[model samples]
Target chain A: MQIQIERIEHIVHENESVKTFFIRGVNDPRPGNYLMVWIPGSGQIPLSISSFKNDLCGFTVKRVGDTTAAMHNLRVGDLIGITGPLGTSFSIRGERILLVSGGIGIAPLLYLAIEARQMGKKVYAICGFERAEDIIFEDVLNGLLDELVITLGERTPLDVIHKLYEKRRFDHIYSCGPEPMMKRVFDFARSSQLGAEFSVERIIKCGMGICGACALPNGMRVCKEGPVFDLEDMEGVWG
Target chain B: MVDLSADIGIPLKNPLILTSGILGSSAHLLKRVASSGAGALITKSITEDPRVGHENPTVIEVSEGLILNAMGLPNPGVDIFLNELETLEAVNLPIIPSVAGYSEDEFGRVASRLEDAGFRIIELNISCPHSTALSSKKVIAQDIDKTRRVVNAVRSVTSLKLIVKLSPNVTDIVEFADVAIKAGADALSLINTIEALEVDPYVEAPVLGNVFGGQSGPSIRCIAQRKLTDIALAMWKGEIERVPLIGVGGVRTPKDVFRFLLLGADAVGIGSSILYEDLAIFEDVIEGLEQIMTDKGYDMLDEFRGKVISQILDMTI
Candidate 1:
């Protein structure tokens, strides 16, 4: 199940610290699907698909911990072992979809936005960054989305979500971001009586769901049952 | 080609058993493991009553092949778990139910129900390190009398092939193995995860939510072999009859499989290493073992199963 990395490039540099690796691999991973990128002697970590088409896929990686730092140092011709296309994909429910992304949590939602556009859905995106210069995927998102709202500085994605909610009602809210941001989104969805789902994070070992390493507070495994879960179904989570 | 199939009273496609508690909570996941080429699959340790287990961060990877977990035996209880097992009735692969309980009667009750529901091989879980969260009592496998009581209670219920799982937490694991064998266990899955703890140096707190966890993977490979050899020598001395041994802890590669077989394990149960390679590991290990056996001119599994045990004592003068 391991594939060779065909090519690699830095797709976006939001700032001095954050950069995206547009890795072209031989997998047609769907939106929300992930690949376990292995650097051999270094170690491996799960990278969510940001874009996939015709044997070319991308993983938007930010240099975070040890494994990711090693992954960031790879060149275009480097051969890395990739396993999966693992886990369930984000389920597109309605005609109008609202994507809330913050920081690197924008990775999976970006692919989801592209898919939503292909399905002829009205995709509304609220992307946030710490500074004005740190905003990424603005051009790509603008072309794919029906409406794109970029918030710079301390204005959180939740703030834009509130402003958007005051104007137009979304059929579904698909969110992935910092826990606090997702929690706020989950709370907003619950209070506003809107359908929403959130992509959660966990210490995943085997992306195939056998290992209980990625199990949530509920018995549900984040690797198998989700990296994405229906906000309403996430009972007692983040409580 | 080597005969990978084994008959430990019940039939197994190979010696690679998908050990309990990995993905045993659901029947769908069990079948997926079955399809993935595992010889057999053991369910998560289920008790008479439902257990919510511990809170988040139940399992974590400490290194490449090592894992620490204190899942506290989270299961849907026996009755609800049976619904999941019933779906597997159509699956051709062998289904072994692992039963855990606080007392002899509780273990007996669950075993009887599993037997009635048509499970042939039942693994009695007496050694879970995280069972402390379920009850204040020490692990049943740690004490000889409690282990005997539970095994005997399950033995009296039905004539199912009972595989008593032993804990590696004890000072003398062979004593517990002898007690289980004497109490009518048809087989034994030796060396459950060794009780150990890992602390976060940065935060100065235990890594596992339960504050302690069982250690598995390559770190415990030598320990598993040493314990299995010790118990095998005891069995050779007529302390207990030779039973089908399922060597469990820290098995990662084909060489480890042969090491366990040489120590008298009829089959090998892989738990933690599955986290490293996924279910694809079963196929990898099986293919590697086959190649190694062919290269060594070993035709049958019995050619090496317990071969190392003969060299353990060497009492002949």
Candidate 2:
């Protein structure tokens, strides 16, 4: 099952260590079909495709582990094995779309923004970072987002959550990030009376579903059941 | 001829069990494993009260292994657990409940509740790597007298079998095993997770939710064999074979189980390896064992528990 590796390039957007690897593949890898980069010796970890536009499949990755560390070591000409276009992707369609992200979690939703923009729908992205040092891909999303509110530092995620509550309503909301950060997004979506919101949870192993590893709120293995689930379905349900 | 009824003193249908942690958090997961073909199930370790546990990202994946944990042993209260067991009792599998505490009173109370509920085995966990040290709760198995007192206190209350789970994180595991035996523990279980650390080279950050986690999985096998042999040799020298010792960690297949038994483990507990396969893996391993036994005409498990040496001797080149 060898697929041609399409090159989706990046420009160093900021001083922070983030790069948007614009990728291309046939059957366009959806907004959440994270590619599994097979590092020769380090094995593989799933990296979400941030955006897939035209013929491009983009991965906005941060150096996180050995496999990721290997990704950071790559040059423009280096080729890596990507085993997916995996998991069920984010399928959202509505008049208004709200996208919230924490840190590197903002990567995948970058594509979703481009997607919503193409559909000529209203889109907003409320992205946050641990500190200013970890921000990336802001320049590309600036023009595409209707409400691209970038919050710097850890505390600002909360501040943004509270601000969104005071104003604005979207037909659909999407979030990805640390569990703590996502927990807040779930609450904000519920409080604002936002009807339908979804979350992209951090999942590991058994992306194919057999390992029983990545469990959701009800011991439902996230990989088999969902990496994307309706916020209303998981509300206050024990994870 | 094949039969599902066999007595290993404990009367298990198969040797495989849901060893510690998997769904040990609640009685519900325990019931699931029991139905999944585990001969028995060991519930996650519990304390006296409800705890909130560690913050998120509490679990992490490292190469061939995983590290988890709620720095918060946050369990539902003991009363809640026993109440659940009231339902668990109907699940039709032996529940080897795990009890942990920083103090004797805590362990004693939890054990008493299970004992009263007619639980047969209570595994007292004393080697949690992430738990806070207690003033009065003695790592008694390390100190003979404290082991004696805690064991005696729990022993005095009930007729249930006692098994003290020893931590591999210690220097001399056999020393602790001796304490458990001297304190009248019925049997022993060895080598809890090894305390280890994994790092992310880029961020230079630790991989686990807890900066350090007890390493489990195939990576710990060589240590497990060494630790098992060390404790076995010590117990053998003391002429104390009556206290059955169960070897845990690194048993990936029937071959590994054979090796552990040869190294002097009376029973074997397959841990993380089971995560890679289905729950019916118990029946698979047991069937493999039966085939091995049939080929050698060793009809009963007792005839082959540690017969690797005997088979080698009987073979002539």
Candidate 3:
């Protein structure tokens, strides 16, 4: 099933290497759903939907591979096949939520932060980048977040969580970043007896949940069961 | 439209079926693929006990079109799988249970239970590439005597149709195919994934946790076709009841399916392509195959079955 991109509304240069493309007329994907984007002749890749405004969706792409470089060349009115809103979403039950992201991992967490704010929940976001110039969505986060802490790579999101957990008393902590960073956060949260969930990044194919290519260590299908898994789901295995 | 239905001891709605390990995680997912247009579906290889399998990095795309995986045959065992099968009865498509075991007794026990559960077909999996990843013992498909004894043991326990899947890792696959057929296999799957290793140069380590895995995709298409051709040629010479060959390994397009059919494959399985295009690829394949048949003036599969082999034999004669 191929859904054609009706239009490209916005293409913002988030940083030196990242670009956010606003694809028009896609189904409104929840916080954790991903789109299997296909560029004719260039091949297909999985992209996390960054922003959602009714039918308009955003994909914050990092120019890291051949496919992403090819995706950067597309202009307005270009046709790109998208199949999706696939994968499990973040649970939105916590009263006070702590959101953390690093690098391109901010794509999904940014959308989640906005959705959580709109629902009248208190959202705290800890965003980290390698340097000052690498920081993205600065203005967006300032407006939606109850508290925004930006780190310039010196301190990780875990460090921020460690300092803030005693003061803020958050109901749930959610994170998506490099594996090492998330693993540290999971460890801290687990030791402190705090509920935490993190989104995993894997090689996803057939986003329709058929291909077991995205299977986790526990044999859970990331395309179907989760890209977002509760901390308990990753217990013992992470250690 | 071309009549793609096949009767390999049992009926299939089309020649394009979902290969084992592609999407056999849960019955709900299998039903989804069946409804999407797959002719039939096979479960992931199941063993007698639950398997935790290899760690993360079990699957990786090594190149543009190839994937290497060492999933280690992760399954919930037959006991739990039987429970899932109860939920799958609502699906209208034919379901074939794939069995993998460490010994002849394990194969017999699993096959016997599945037989009692009324499964129409049982695919004996002797070809998992990573079966030896945790241990030093050779996979059953790699040994002729082991293959024969395992197949015979399962055959004794079940009267249902038996399809023994073969490995492409062997020196002479046709020899093992002959032994399996003699041991009472009703059909055969041409090839499982080829044994391969991918080393990450940046880190100087094996990419898969199991150190080695199976290479699947367009890279193995011709190899599988050649193996199927060789075995079909041998079977023709031996006049061995013409057991249907289920061709697998890198079938992405209807043209690929036609190539397997020309090589004497009664049915074809789509594996790695599922990673590229998803289950809807089945519908595209069936439709593309129909269009190709219409253009080539093929109304039935029999008209084109082994047509390439016949042409080659005619030229030689």
Model 1 reaches an interface RMSD of 10.0
lDDT of 3 by residue, A110-220 (tens): 988988888999998888888888888989889889888888767777677777777778888888889888888888878888788888888765454545656664556
Tens-place lDDT digits, model 2, residues B209-296: 4455566776778788878777766565554445777778867777777677677667777766655554666767777776776776
Q: What is the lDDT of residue B83 in candidate 1?
A: 81
Q: Report, for every candidate in turn, its global Cα lDDT versus the true structure.
A: 0.79, 0.65, 0.81
Residue-by-residue lDDT tens digits, candidate 1, A1-239? 32333446435565565666665544567788887765644555778888876666778777888777777677766556666787778888878889998887888998899888888889998988887776778888888888889877788888878889777678899988888889888888888888888888886755656555566655567887788889755765764
Off by over 4 Å in 3: A1-221, A224-239, B134-137, B239-241
User: What is the per-residue lDDT of model 1 for residues B252-287, given as tens digits with 9 covering 90 to 100?
Assistant: 888889889888888898877776676788889999
What's each prediction's clash count?
0, 7, 0
Better of 2 and 3 by lDDT: 3
Top of the candidates by lDDT: 3
Query: Chain A TM-score, candidate 3?
Result: 0.94
Worst 10 residues of 2 chain B by lDDT: B132-141
